[model samples]
Target: MNSIGDNCTELKKKYDSCFNQWFSERFLKGDTDDSVCAPLFKIYQQCVKDAMKVQHIEFKEIEGDVLGSDKEQKVPPKSGSSSS
Candidate 1:
């Protein structure tokens, strides 16, 4: 997969590594502490946010306060209001 930020490919990879480890080692083990990958996630998120701005990607919040909550529900048909 490609990096979300143009210049932060390495940073993203580094963060991904940390995240995968955390998920398998801590989170799967019932550890909910987020301190392990907090710093790395911050850096990766900032880089991607900057890239999104540079690419003119309009960032908007979802009305239901959900991320990727059901693609069919989020996308409406041009003819009708079907939430299927």
Candidate 2:
């Protein structure tokens, strides 16, 4: 898959390749370390951020947890419940 930023595509590809190799060669073997692809990922991430800025998309807006995982769930009150 291509990156959001055209300029970042190469970096993303490099990171993806490294990650895939690491996952299959190291992670699957129980090595568990992922620093091998960190540098490439950082570069790709920065490029995407720059693209987002050029597109007028605020980073903070997309940084929120879309899954609402940290939110407290509220249960509906029972029909038999009475108000004060």
Candidate 3:
């Protein structure tokens, strides 16, 4: 099941398919072009944004705070930091 909604499932699948193909064929082949899946992804993104709005989700705030932030967070040291 999609996290967005049932209405976006089909679009998500289509976008996923396009993305997988692009990743495997073009990306792996060192083709950095993103035109192939751009359209599909754009539509899928719009659908997800609309669904999130309907669910009262603040997509921009979530995205900005989670991903757009440049602050570097520290990772805790492992219990055993020494090499075996």
Q: Score every model by TM-score.
A: 0.66, 0.73, 0.71
Q: What lDDT is obtained when candidate 3 is compared to the true structure?
A: 0.83
lDDT of 2 by residue, 1-84 (tens): 888788888888888899999999999999988998898888888999999999899988777565657554666789998989
Worst 10 residues of 1 by lDDT: 61-70
**Which regions of candidate 1 fall more than 4 Å away from where they truly are?**
61-84
C-alpha positional error of residue 2 in candidate 1 after TM-score superposition, expressed in Å = 1.5
The numbered model that scores best in lDDT is 2
Q: Which candidate is the best by TM-score?
A: 2
Clashing pairs in 1: none
How much is the lDDT of residue 12 in candidate 3? 92
In model 3, the Cα lDDT at residue 62 comes to 66
Report the error of model 1 at residue 41, Å: 0.7
Off-target runs (Cα >4 Å) in candidate 2 are: 68-84
Q: RMSD per prediction, one decimal?
A: 5.4, 5.4, 5.3
